[model samples]
Target chain A: MSEKHLQTGDALPPFGGKLRLFAMRFCPYAERSVLVLNAKNIPYDLVFINLDQKPEWIFNFSPRGAVPALEYEQGKGIFDSNVINVYLDEKYPEVPLQAADPLRRAQDKLIVENFSAAQSAYYTAAFNAQALQPSHLENYHKGLELLQKELETRGTKFLHGDQAGLVDYTLWPFLERFEALPLLGKSEYAIDKSKYDILLTYMESMKQVPAVKTYYLSADMHAKFTESRVKGDPNYNMLDSSAEVCCFRPRKKKE
Target chain B: MSEKHLQTGDALPPFGGKLRLFAMRFCPYAERSVLVLNAKNIPYDLVFINLDQKPEWIFNFSPRGAVPALEYEQGKGIFDSNVINVYLDEKYPEVPLQAADPLRRAQDKLIVENFSAAQSAYYTAAFNAQALQPSHLENYHKGLELLQKELETRGTKFLHGDQAGLVDYTLWPFLERFEALPLLGKSEYAIDKSKYDILLTYMESMKQVPAVKTYYLSADMHAKFTESRVKGDPNYNMLDSSAEVCCFRPRKKKE
Candidate 1:
């Protein structure tokens, strides 16, 4: 019975080593990490993990069993996307992801937390409407409404002050997914360009933020995400993500 | 709107320059930051946040609203215990909280993620029961069983390597809470000390670690937590630590 271990007693990986991003594009959690990578000019080998039938190593490696995990050559892999975002900003300070000041960092943290946490209702409501399991709709909608009101208030170019700082990069890419989803047939929940002009404007601005603009999701990866996979394969988690598993539940077989 | 911004143009706060830890002793999320503090030996002023009536400043300053938030000075604050843990470890590298080797770090991330996450389910089972609500009791218990099984297979002293590294520090304290619980009526749910001798022994050994022995939770803070108001407070994201909230839903007064 051999146990696997990462020997710290050995040689170190090079500085400009392979950085792996394991995620599904539509996933806001994964997107947060992507936004930072785009915000930073970090080159990475993108491994689209099949999240449904997750590989043993992924589950073995990621204790929480979530996506947007990163494998950095120099240190341990980052599990939480929020955690990864901060790490990306700190490790690669060249581009600067977080605001220089600490108070603003707190504000940015608030926004990121809201983005990751608050909008669950909207996702729950719409997620599997086709499947009809009744996920977290009421709570999800309430969260979105609260967010919409906050979006109304900010009315800025980003979540933090007028500029995109750690929080904006931490949260915006995830919002774009919200932007695309139909919010319970409500003609949208938050960024409506009318009231939250700044929210939409900021998103447009985010697209132009050099590194963010260059952030890419290949067609093949996108295709892989939506495609169903053979059951019991370790790579299933990667493919499982393509089903948009987080925002909703699954449809009956052959849906 | 006299909005306080930190990064772009706002000035950093002057207070807490010596390092201030806003944490609760029993909280696993808060412990992540504490572990970094202990490992780094960064002297700090512990501001025990009232989890129930969480001081308005926590929500006002921190959007998600929680403790384990770090204030370096009056002007700066870092939120998200998980992120703060990584930040503290990196900024104060006297005793690093992360693995120096990349692969090991990735593996450590997995162990931490799994353990922390399972702890969440475990807490959910207990707290949900306390609230007299239906819970994922089976699933939560299953997670515990899985954790116990994993520990049986993993090494003796610490996770991944010999000494107590990041993974060890992040989880040891959390498990301590479960071990110390009253078990109420669920005897089977109670951790059978004999079943996992390695874990029990390791936990005992961990108590001897300088960082572990030096750990202290203020008595006043404990009163706030074991009480109600644990729900949705900024102090507990219910995400960072394997956390769950319990409360005797609002009661009607005999007015």
Candidate 2:
């Protein structure tokens, strides 16, 4: 539950018999699984790890030492956000996050697939400004347009209908981070209110969702993290104080 | 049923009310779906397209004009092999190709995710030999070892229990082509029988699977195609003659 990212030489936390998620504080991919876990109301323990200087034990949970690896059983793990998310949805069907219809499920996946170009564009614009090009911006807008059109066609409160399902959860992390782009002086990456009224409304609704609200960070916070990351010394523990306060203040109130 | 790759000027084939798959002859990803369809006994139409000069309608089926797109309905299409395969498995549950257990399914996907390094290595060695490095070879061997170890541990005729399943069909395409690496002078990429006896036995058994046997190409044929591909002019229609004979000869015999 700590915002502090465990680095190399850090001891592996003892399994508390709850589902454990290996993630980094700022990774969008990791946020994906986090959102799913939250949405599903699945009981889980979050272990934030420093991706730059990964803990040795992360490899045990994820072969590539990537974030969003789920330790489903003791010493057994599944990596990849999509893989873990799908497994979690299936394993804990109490609150199913995916469409029951297989075709709809496939369509949901395609939406994610089609949106990948925008993600790549966001990365280039954020971390490697020099590499950012006109085409990258074009692709970024194109992806946004595609999503908007899909929303129009689907005509739902969320892409997942009445409730935000796996598709919505999967994409929300990236959309959440996209707001940071304009703050980082990349105004071209902005999702303009005029052009994206529906998207903006959906995003606002997502922010209000109890699950996302718990872990949502502001565009300003994301910009600060992006700046720190760009400077080559990411402040992974920047939110630790707030996290500690958030964790204990509730207990104090109950007492 | 033609092995001939349809180019830009070609007309879109009429939908016969059956499932239709858009694929390329030599693409491993496309072959994955074909194997699955064959395994499921799904009477589907196969449309081979020239990736370089893709037919305009290919975009209607696959936005990016990539292979293994499934036209499940008259006009609606779903792209991505995993997406299409999973949908097919779910839509037609009579012959399920995945494990009933969610955890095992996750494990199967993990195996594919882990083995991607070797697939990349194979691509480099096949098409970009100049870029091939010792690490690539090491990764390739590591993938084989991992798979062999998996076979030993599972102790099943195939990755999917007694019969070959999605996992088996997914990996088999690359394994089938791996044999050509040695023929292309990349002997280090070869799966040495002594080192991978279990894997070799598994591969032999997989080749005999009815689904695989129908579409299986010999190492020589794969090597020939590899050579053509590397020469900057892929002979996509090289197998057209044999395909024609195989298709008509059966009908002729019945008559």
Candidate 3:
């Protein structure tokens, strides 16, 4: 878990009092941690977590059985995606989540709120067969459209504004699937590559951040997990699913 | 909003002030803030949140339409139950969520994760109309039985150990519902007031916490919310089927 010894797959000595990331690439939740550490230029070792056959350490570590946990110096474990994100921000105030203005800081929380609990409906639609249903697609598109609208007007180059702040970095990875819903079937608001130009630009800029680039999309992940739903079709689980397939499984997003 | 005027019913004056917890009786999340605040002993205003109509100011502060938000006068305002809970604990590290031992704290997060997130199915089963269904009820009881069984060998009084900390306080009110649940529907293994003497004693001990007794389960709350949920033919909000006629709703136990 030491920053000095990065994810080079060496002897894998004990994390000598360094930050460690507990994650699986396919999981949107775990991906956020990678983005944060990458964004802040915080060096940490990445411990790959296998969800189907979990690592023994993760069981007691991740109570809810999810990936993307953070271990700070041996055992300062913080679960619940948002909690760890803010903890990293607060603990390392150099990259802060809030602004000098209290109201603006509170506003940052609203952005995270949409991504976390409020987005439940969107994910529900995305996950279920309902994404194929015409009316349901409308709702899914509507939710993304609403987010885009919010970001365009009030949001910044990043989610908080100007700089890529905590909420922005945290949510960008999860939003990669916005276009996939329509692929499952079809939708009124098409978001393949055309409709969401700003969103696309935003995503690209977010990815370009050194830390984000280092951890995600290009991490040279050890093993890619493919659930039964995402069996051997190259069309499925590819990196470009956001611009292609609509009905992608969790594993699909990882690719 | 001002810790000085928690009961004053005014938004915390814009000048960054302090954290005031406007809470309702039996709200577990509010208990989270209060416990952390007391443990940290951070000076805060503990006011009674009026849940009946939901005071207008609260809506302005939290648009998601929920309570357990810390309209921070000193720090930035934070809403959402879980986010605020971790924020307070991290910000004021007097009584850190992670116990002195690193692994201990990590395990605490596990307790929160499993109980907080995993138990949602049980909550839905117990409260939702599905709870009325035989299958859902069966799953619901099964989840509870699993939790109760886990509690059997954990530690001393609380979920972690002798110390009644965050994880224990967070779930106290909702677990009390377990006590009330068996009473409501004569379930085979839902929460027998007699069967689990340990949990019952903890419930009693938890209610005795000054913050718990004074702020959370105060005298008028029974008249305000619970009386309606558990009481004598109270007016039910048929509009929200989720709003049962029963005399409960222990501060949503955070859906």
Candidate 4:
């Protein structure tokens, strides 16, 4: 999967008959479906698109040109991260990611719903610092505390019993990005080891999971990308080594 | 089943060992779950609550005291309309409301998601008239047109085939209320017969469904309630005939 984001005027790659996911490299929502696909061991192609300069064909897959649209068939698509994730889980029931009990499923959704405020607070702190408030920090901490309490109550290695499930994958992307907050000068958003011992341990275990490990970006890397996004010009191709070939030519001559 | 909404002073009603739904009389989100329960023929208790002056115990059922909270088991509650509706459908699968195919279920969700703009537009037009824009009206028609086209494509008596299923029940509440917009002096929001021929037919079919017929209020009734709400004093017990007995005492003497 290339980190290079296809933008406007870019031709869509020919369909190779496997499931395709339209995504942005740094988007947490898109990362959700990616983690789910990996966890389910579903063979799929990832097409990273520049959200700012979205490809025309992207609209064919997603009405709003949003990322994480799954091209289940050659031209047919399903948009929204949650919609895509749930569909994938149900379609490929061989590796079920949801609880069999309906009430448990509802509770899992509630956890994600409850954590939404923290996600919003993170966005405001990272991109729109002018809107940052004490309440945002309070809500963010509240979300973390709630998750910690839930983890303690569940008393499992992961939220999904022994193995991480849809709930874990749905939230893991946000948790992964929260580590970058302190690095981005929002120290108040830090997941302190003292306060979040259990949560931090759970997060660490999540990192080691093959699905997350394959796509996880470090806090420093996320911080760097966030800095670029905050500066108005998002460096969508920051990790594209092929794009660095031109820059490396002079360094090679110097060496 | 009382139209009378329970307020802050109301005592906790004893659990009758049945599924209990906490809801407001006019809340569309709450109505979604109510319709599902009715459709599934689930033995349940409906506890109407005053949204403005909510009962203290509502928070026990819903974290934020939002309506459509389901006490699935004794003291154990699940909130959010979609969450509750889906839970009910899954828990009571003897009368499955969702599509058997996972992809179709995803599509059903997408239709509801796409129609949300129109729902928001209806809110602005009804309560916050100053915020109403031409785009809102356009989006409203677009939603209707989209639904009409979907009906044409599906060629089904209802969105959920011959029977009104989860998708129909999920969206019917808003459609029911939209009829009141014109009555509330927002003629631009009317679902014109010519424009939405198929959708209008679908709406007619939905109204006859046992689930909706039992809980639906007419456009005039909805308009009256909206007027009360907009005037800052909602007549929550307008339908409670027992409360009307006191006013009828003088008239009874005249008779």
Candidate 5:
């Protein structure tokens, strides 16, 4: 994968027969789909796009040109993280990511809906510090407390029993980013060990999930990206490299 | 069925084993769930709430106090129109509202997503007239054009084929309200018969569906409701009366 984002004037990459995911390297929403694909062990190609200078073809895949559009076929595609994730789960049902019970599925969606406040608070605190408020911090902690309560009630290694499910992957990207808030000088947004012992434990377990382990970034690394984004020039290509060793193939022997 | 807007002092209705849908009578989002419940022949109780002065118990059904919330169980509830609607469809698969094919299901969701701009434009035009803009109108028609083109390609009587599926029910609420725009004096949002002939035919066909037919409101009726809402005091109780006959039952003889 090239870390250089395809921008305006760039041609669409030639279609690969395997599934194609149009993503922004730093977008949490894109990361959700990537983590799901990886968890499901679906082989796919990833194409990063410059959000500020989106290529003309991005709209063809995603009407709004949003990241995480999946080109399931040669030309046709689906967008939205949840929508795409659900589609991929249903289409490739070899390893199901959703709950078997319909009601449980609805409850899972509710959990995601309920946690949105913290996600918003994190965004405001990290990217627009001036807009951050005491109420935002309150809401952030309220969301955390709710997650802790839920974790206690479920009493599982992960939210979806012994194994992480769609609900876990859906919320993991945002949780991964939340850790960066404290490093970004927003101590109020930190997940206090004493207060959120259970949620913190769940986070630790999630980090060990093989799928997340491969794509996980450190809080310090996320802080760096956040700072660059706050400066109006996102360091989207900070991870620039086309030669990273991938699981699909062994690294070529050093010549 | 009472048009009386239940306030904070209102008592929670007795629980019925059948599904209970808490909704705002005139909200398009709520209407989405109503149409779905009716379409599926699901025996559910409908309790309309005054959105401004909501019943205290609504929070038990929806944490944010937003409708339509479904009390799938006696005390437990699920919120969000899409969430509730999808739950109902999946929980009661006797009459499937979704396409059997996963890709088609993804496409159906895309159709609704692509139409959201138009839904937004209609909202502004109907309620916040001052904020209406040329771009809003452009996006509104763009959505309509996209739907029309989709209709041409799919060549189905309904977006879901012979039967009205989730996509139809999802988009119909907005289309039903779009007609009210012209009646409310926002002529720009009208679906002109000349340009939208096929789309108009589709609308007429949708009106004839037993589910939509039972809940269908005329453009004039919708206009009156929109006017009342725009005037600051939404006549939420305008439809008051549990006596009104529903598709599920015949009116009881008066003593």
Candidate 6:
């Protein structure tokens, strides 16, 4: 199925009739679109890209050469996780991932917006531990506290409702990665069972969701990937056994 | 109506039983929500916030105290321009601002995404000239060229259609601010008639949009405001003579 990331000088893969998504294996933003595609039960092909040595053709799919670019048609494409996810939900509306109420949807986006600081802190803690600050830890817990408060206010199994919807998928990737922070010796990011009982319960339910279950990587795997990335080389194909031979070769540092 | 920005020690304005939007006079993001409200012709009150001296109550409306937070109801609000704008469009569907087609909507967002480099260049040129580089100028023109090509492909008076829509309004604020760059002696940021014939024509058409025209500040006025901002004291009240007296008093730096 040619699931590999075609690097520089690699020929553009032949396009099948199905929708194709350009993604990076370990990117939370790319996971966003992937989760939306899975939740909608849409038939699509995923092409994992090596962000460090991106294929020349990626520019055709995404102007900025970023991930989560959806090729809706043969020659045309759209990028940005929010833009692509919204388009997928609207285009394939059989299984609606968004709320019927506009206010709920707006609130969902607000939750994502508010959580960005925590996301940044996670990135710093995971990949640049030397730069980590007290504020990063504070912001991370603040984000978790806000999420817990929101869960109590809504009295729902997930942020979207009883079922995991767009909001859950949008944030779950970060939560998935957040688990790895503690494993990487950053215990401050650990989600304490006592303090975050509600959030933990919600996370368990989200993990059980069929769509999330399929693409979900464990904390150990995320920690390994984070370590590789922190060492100045990212093992983007760690999960793909087919690409294990390439992983045996010495990694090249990006110029 | 006290449309003025309340600062520290000032009382939170009493609810007036109407939709209120917290904004700044020259902020591009704030202009986004304002333009959306104006386009929808939704009855809303505009309260220009002193971003430098944000009122203690602004935090209630916007968590980060950023401008363009929509106070939909008394004491309840939503932040982020995209979130607030989408809410306004859906909440008041009498005048639809987004494209009916999902693909078109996605394309519109991409256009904004692609044009962001130029917006940043505009910011650097206007406020921090020392940081300006050749690549910034190159990106600025690349953005203009891209817009011109899109206009040619769309073959419409506006990006949305005959009338300006959310896409048009979303990009207009930056274009409106870009004009000030030329007046600030940054000729490299100028959209010359010879170079941007199609884009210039489109810009002219947008200026005629009743929604845009109402809140539109002339380039000269924008230049004056930009100079003040670059000098570390933004003349947010320059256009409003009624609020000019407050501007004369020694402005206090935010704690």
Q: What is the interface RMSD of candidate 4, in Å?
A: 0.4
lDDT of 4 by residue, B1-255 (tens): 677788889987899999999988888999999999999999999999988778999998898999989998899899999999999888889999999999999999999999999899999888888888899999898888888999999999999898889999999999999999999989888888878888998999999999999999999988888887787767677788766654224322211
What TM-score, computed on C-alpha atoms, does each candidate reach?
Answer: 0.61, 0.94, 0.62, 0.96, 0.93, 0.96
Root-mean-square deviation (CA) per prediction: 11.1, 6.5, 9.0, 4.7, 6.7, 2.0
What is the TM-score (0 to 1) of chain A in model 2? 0.94
Q: What is the DockQ of candidate 1?
A: 0.13
Residue B105 displacement in candidate 1 (angstroms)? 2.8
Q: How close is candidate 2 to the true structure, as a TM-score?
A: 0.94
What does candidate 5's lDDT look like per residue over A7-125, in tens digits? 88999999979999999877999999999999999999999998988899999899889999999999988999989999999999998989998998999898999999989998999
lDDT for model 2 comes to 0.91
lDDT of 5 at B58: 95
lDDT of 2 by residue, B1-255 (tens): 888889899999889999999999889999999999999999999999988789999899889999999999998899999999999999999999999999999999999989999999999999999998999999999999999999989989898899999999999999999999999998888899889999999999999999999999998899998987787767777889864544223222111
Candidate 5: pairs in clash: B3-B240, B3-B241
Query: TM-score, B chain, candidate 4?
Result: 0.95
Evaluate candidate 1 and give its CAPRI docking class based on DockQ: incorrect
Residues A4-75, candidate 2, lDDT per residue (tens digit)? 889899999999999999998899999999999999899999999987888999999888899999999899
* lDDT (Cα, tens digit) per residue for candidate 3, span B130-219: 344455555545545545665676746666566666676666655555444443343553555666565566667777766455544432
After superposing all C-alphas onto the true structure, candidate 5 shows an RMSD in angstroms of 6.7
Higher-TM-score candidate among 3 and 6?
Answer: 6
Give a tens-digit lDDT track for model 6, residues B104-162. 99999989989999898888888899998999998988988999999999999999999
| C-alpha positional error of residue A36 in candidate 4 after TM-score superposition, expressed in Å | 0.4
Task: List interface RMSDs for the candidates, in order.
Answer: 5.0, 0.5, 5.4, 0.4, 0.6, 0.5
For residue B145, model 2's alpha carbon misses the true position, in angstroms, by 0.6
